[model samples]
Target: MRPSTQIKPISLLKTQTAQVIRRVCEDREPLIITQNGEAKAVILDIQSYEDQQDTVALLKILALGSRQIAAGEVKPAGEVFERLRKLER
Candidate 1:
């Protein structure tokens, strides 16, 4: 978060929606939308949102791999590579 970033009220969002959208896209930062001085929602550009989703998906995959390893459901790297090579043939 930037030092200059401020929480915007819902009223301001309703009135200056276009400006908010433009700023979010240009800055690639999420805007905190507030209501009654309470944080309510977040506004993000499409690309940033997609990037966040991708990052979360990758984290989930890493966690799953760790769990599998802990459960002893793992294989040797060399054997996995050999199977892949056979599949490529």
Candidate 2:
């Protein structure tokens, strides 16, 4: 995040929505939309938004796997591979 990046007021969004969209897409950076000097929302390019969603989904899956492991709800590696091989058939 660059300190020099200007934060736009929410009111400007009503009139400069297209400009904001173009800038964010071209720079691949989020625009902070502010209201009354406080951060209110962010505008992200479609690719960045989807990438963020994917990252969050992956993190959730990893968290679930960690919890399962902690609960001893995991099979041995060889056993898991054997089951996968059977499924392949």
Candidate 3:
């Protein structure tokens, strides 16, 4: 199991916004923002966030493809390309 990572409240972060953001970005770490003593949002580095989102999208595509294959709805790679080639003619 992965260890838990904790972050301070947003109000406390307001004091050293630049420093805190920089540290989190460099570390690829997530910061839990809180309001009224409750967790409100999470802040993450843009690149790290993008990478995670891309991974999710790729996984979804693979899952859909797997489902289609399981249902016998997929075409062979060569046949798919041949059909496309005819369409281009």
Candidate 4:
């Protein structure tokens, strides 16, 4: 689901933006901006932006784990015990 509705040209922004921004701020939706009839940028609420960042971080960590597993860098659970036993001795 889209977080924000679309707001057209920047010219209409001054009058329309405050209202649109207020709605997005209250409901946590993003405002899609346009320029010369093409998609320009997005205006996001801070909380939504922060959430996106956290999701990106999680994806990066998962990708690193996947790469390590593909590189055969993984060990079995029992091998952990063997390593600990050797250390104790």
Worst 10 residues of 3 by lDDT: 1-10
What are the per-model C-alpha RMSD values against the true structure?
1.8, 1.7, 2.6, 3.3
lDDT of 4 by residue, 1-89 (tens): 45234555666666676877777688786777778877788788889999999999999999999999999999997999999999999
- Alpha carbon deviation, residue 2, candidate 2 (Å): 1.1
Deviation from native of the Cα of residue 39 in model 4, angstroms: 0.6
TM-score of 4: 0.72
**What order do you get sorting by TM-score, best first?**
2, 1, 3, 4
lDDT of 4: 0.80
The residue pairs found clashing in candidate 2 are none
- Cα lDDT of model 3 by residue, 1-89, tens digit: 12255557787688988988897888888888888878888888999899999999999999999999999998899999999999999
Question: Model 3, residue 76: displacement in angstroms?
Answer: 2.0
**For every model shown, what is its TM-score relative to the native structure?**
0.86, 0.86, 0.76, 0.72
Q: Which residue pairs show backbone clashes in model 4? A: 3-29, 3-30, 4-30
lDDT of candidates 1 onward, in order: 0.90, 0.91, 0.84, 0.80
- Model 3 accuracy (lDDT, Cα): 0.84
lDDT of 4 at 83: 100
Judged by whole-model lDDT over C-alpha atoms, candidate 1 comes out at 0.90
| Runs in model 2 lying further than 4 Å from the true structure | 3-6, 86-89
Encode model 2's per-residue lDDT on 1-89: one tens digit a residue: 68458578999898988888998999998888899999999899999999999999999999999999999999999999999999999
